[model samples]
Target: MSLRRILKSWVERYFSDEEALILLLVLIAGFAAVIWFGRMLAPFFTALVIAFLLQGVVSALTRRGIPHLLSVIVVFLGFVGVLLALAFILLPLIWDQLIGLVQETPRMFASGQNWLDELQSRYPNLITPDQMQNWIGVASREISQLGQRALTLSLASLGNLLSLIIYLVLVPILVFFMLKDREALVGFTLSLLPQKRALMARIWREMDDQIANYIRGKFIEIIIVGTVSFITFSFFKLPYTALLAVLVGFSVLVPYIGAAVVTLPVAAVAGFQFGLSESFVYVLVAYGVIQALDGNVLAPVLFSETNNIHPVSVIVAVLFFGGIWGFWGVFFAIPLATLLKALVHAWPRGMKGRDERHHALASEESMEESL
Candidate 1:
């Protein structure tokens, strides 16, 4: 048969409904497998993300005429220094509070039991004192068991400290190499594609730009939120202010739920120490003001065009990933979602179709300036 006839027959066969269904099923199965594997490798993935973020810093340093090796060392040392400073400033306070809380656990349980007993005596229709005592006993036992398990894990993992050391040592090294060789990697990958598809390199570069901008903007936002939270909590004379502020900062890394989760614990402690009404109002107002500032001022100034995710999408991604993969999932949901959005935006459009529909507004600006 002629080449045109053969080509027509091949297209007809391959683009049939049955072929399309099979392709769809295969794609779905492949995606499921990838997700399962990713879940299993979550920790390494987390480390890689950390490295990816730091790679930009390393690149900047190199661009400033710093040697790659020295830049990596400086970045790693800076990270360690920050961690040490936080530990020195915050750990002692947290240790004292933790010790006090541990010592007071029995007292808290007794107080709870006493309250239950008084309620039983007043009503005589609620749970009997004996039942309340049994419930307390069960709860106390569970708490004791959980504490023992946690202690055991901590102790047993001391020998495994070397693994963590290795990871810490390797990440900066990997990041330095990645930053130094990024262009080469891109060129090598693109070389494998046909000339017709070589323009994908530009698309990939745009995607990388989006990811880098979002990550850098996010870090700045977290720092701003943390600083604001620390100042607010300190002014209010809240308990565990340092720890709570750190929690708030980390929560800001996640979207939507971060502020709420950070505030809840701080509010609970405040309520217990002060009074319910005062603590509730204080935390509610403090977080509200901070959030308002973040939304109106800080975000617009720093992350103006970086992350354009809808609030609904943020909530859904957090819930879905958090459910499947726990804390890391929640922590990474927004960045990962942002990366996916970038990829979708970068995907090649049909030759005769509308091509700008999926692109971010920032990319349009870049295009306009280039033109």
Candidate 2:
């Protein structure tokens, strides 16, 4: 086929449908907004996400014979209560843990240097005096700079504190109004769009369910994993248990990579605190069990009916989105990947098949293989 013919064929095959065009434009606009005003509008976006998550609870309450306003109020209050608890109790505990961890750093380095020295003595050929001295020098410099960096970060955090306060105040207000006026908000948003939104509506319906399930499941996973980790670490008398638990909980946001990367800190803390004692082994085993159960059992149950994108697609989404949007990007990687998968599968082609759904499935499978 001629190049022009191939181009025409591809466009017709994938983009001839008006719905596909609309979807493409919407995605482009959404991405642009995120890239452009992501930091400036962080609170609004955060509020939107909280509203989305809480919508399910509000809906459930309404279904259980509660009035919508009452439901919104109840859910909003519950959310505020959690926020208050985090601010007053959890935040202070984590802050102390962070300070303790920082204070322990010098000792940790000393212990590490001792180990390196022992290794160098045992393997003279492998690690010479010059190399050992160089390593120690680098470590000392890092330790020295650590205090300076912490002070700088402390100053920087004051600015971040203002932003955080804005978020804490604004997010709840936005969420409350969003929940209370859900229909008005939806109607207003839909009113701004063109009258014909068949394709957009279909995509929204699919995305709404998937996104809701995914978000709720993730929140549950984080809470379960974090709480369990905190309990386990506390029981084992591990230092920085709260901080490490929070890290482990959030690590689930990145699937396989998260668990592995977070294991380093947990093991390091355990080793530093307890050396090779039985408590260290027990801590590691318990941590391993939490990860295993989360992956093997919890995730499967939670996401069984949600998007089923390949692991490769997931990792790519994490790298791509996380590169662009940083932490939140990595956090929402899977859902975003699933959204793309949905768009691809649902993109209308001019050609007709005996079974259209089956054809879409086949096309999606082909696309996945290419990816």
Candidate 3:
């Protein structure tokens, strides 16, 4: 076939289906809105997510014979109660732990420097003075950068306080109405959609189930891991148990890397405190068990269906989305990746089998090779 014929074939394969065109247009429009006006619509988007998460609870209660409006009120109150507890109970509890860690920082730095000096003294050939100096310089610069960022955020907080207040005020109101008027809202949205939304509905169903499981499973995982870690560390009389537990909890946000990074501090604290004794071994073993169980057992149970995306794909998605949207992007990277995969799998292709398309391309390649 000529080049023009190949181009026509490709266009027909991609764009001949009406449903595919509509889906493509909708995806483009949605992405455009988020990319162009993300900051402006962030609060509304945030409200939508919270309401979507809480919908499960409202639905569960409704199924148990409770009225929809009553369920909404009950769930909303529970949500507010969580916020209050975080503000009042959780903050004060962690504040003391933070202060203790801050106070120990200088001591830890001095000890680290002394240790480096000792290493240089003992292994002059392996660890030269110049190498040690360079390492220390790098460490110092990194610490300075971290401190500068914190200071910048502190200054930014004051200017952003009104925005924060607006979010707090507006999000809850939006969430409430969203939950209370859920049916009407959904009806309105569906009415706006195209009459033939079979493809859209299918995508919605798949996304709904997976996203719900992923989000809820994550929330539960964090709580369970954190609570277990806190109890285990406390039982072992580890210093800074609260702070370490919090780190371990949030570490689940990043699958493999977070746990590994956190293990350094835990082992360091244990080694400094216990000096390679039985208790130190015990703590590490316990931590290892928790991680093993989470990876092998808890995660599998929580997410019954495999996402079928590779770890490399996951990491790339995280990097790509996180670069665009920052923290929230990182958090939702897996779901977004899964959504992309679903879209690719479901995209119309002029009724051609994917394998057939691949075979045709391979045949062309073989013909070119022979020629």
Candidate 4:
């Protein structure tokens, strides 16, 4: 047979249905293995996230005429110093409030029962006090069990604390090397690709820009949310304002629904502490205002370009990852979504051919322009 006929026959043989099915299974298994491995390497994943976030700061310092080593040192020292200061300032307050809350748990339970009694008195058709008490008892038992489990987990990792310290020590060292050699790393990676595909270097740079913008925007948003929450809590004369505000603020890092998770518990406690009506209204209004500001003003201004994800995609990713990986999944949902979007845009259009590829490239270029 001629060479052309032999080439055509080889292609046809390789593209057979059985081969395709085998390939599909292989791909699926490979993907599953990757996910499992990623889960197993969770601590390294966390460290990588921390490094990615601090990269921009270190780069900025380096660009401003600081030596790379000194820049890394400065960034690391500043970070640790800030954390230490915050610990000194905030931990005592939080510790005291937590201790007080533990001591007052019985009183809080009584207050809850009183509130239930008031509700029953106002609406005689409601459930009986005995039923309510039973429900509360069940809830209390569950909460106590959860608390015990949490304490066990915390104490169980006492030996791992040394490893955590080593990780903390090594992170800045890794960051320093990464920041110093980032350009070289990029050049090396690009060199591995064929010359015809060098244009992809630009695409990678763009993706990096997108990720950096997102990280910086998120930092700003967290600060804004925390400050606003603290101010609002102080305005309402709420108990444990510092602790609650800090919780709410830090929870903002998780994207979409996390702020509410933090707020709801604080509000519930506030309701039990103050009158139900007063605390309910205060927390409701405060959180509502903060969310509105976040959605309308702060988000639009800072995250307008960074969050190119659709609401449906966000919800799907959150649910899928949350189910698979729990808290870490939820924390990483947005960044993961962003990375997925980048990959989708970068993927080759095979079935649709060059026209579709061109169109996709054009659309991506337009999106970059808009950004």
Q: Specify the highest-lDDT model's number.
A: 2
lDDT by residue (43-144, candidate 3, tens digit) is: 898888788789999999999999999999999999988977876788677878776765576565566677789889989999999999998898778667
What is the lDDT ranking, best to worst?
2, 3, 4, 1
Model 3: pairs clashing at backbone N, Cα or C within 3 Å: none
Every candidate's lDDT: 0.67, 0.87, 0.84, 0.70
Please write out the lDDT profile of model 4 over residues 60-166, one tens digit for every residue: 98899989888877877786776567657777788777666665666776787788888888887777778887988986996688678757866976766676666
Extract clashing residue pairs from model 1: none
The CA lDDT at 279 in model 4 is 65
Please estimate how well model 4 matches the true structure, expressed as its whole-model Cα lDDT: 0.70
Error of 4 at 311 (Å): 1.7
Clashing residue pairs, backbone N/CA/C < 3 A, model 4: none
Model 3: weakest 10-residue lDDT segment is 351-360
TM-score list, all predictions: 0.66, 0.90, 0.86, 0.75
* Model 3 residue 348 distance off true place after TM-score fit, in angstroms: 1.3
Residue-pair clashes, model 2? 0
Model 2, position 196, has a per-residue lDDT of 60
Ranking by TM-score: 2, 3, 4, 1
lDDT, residue 190, candidate 3: 91
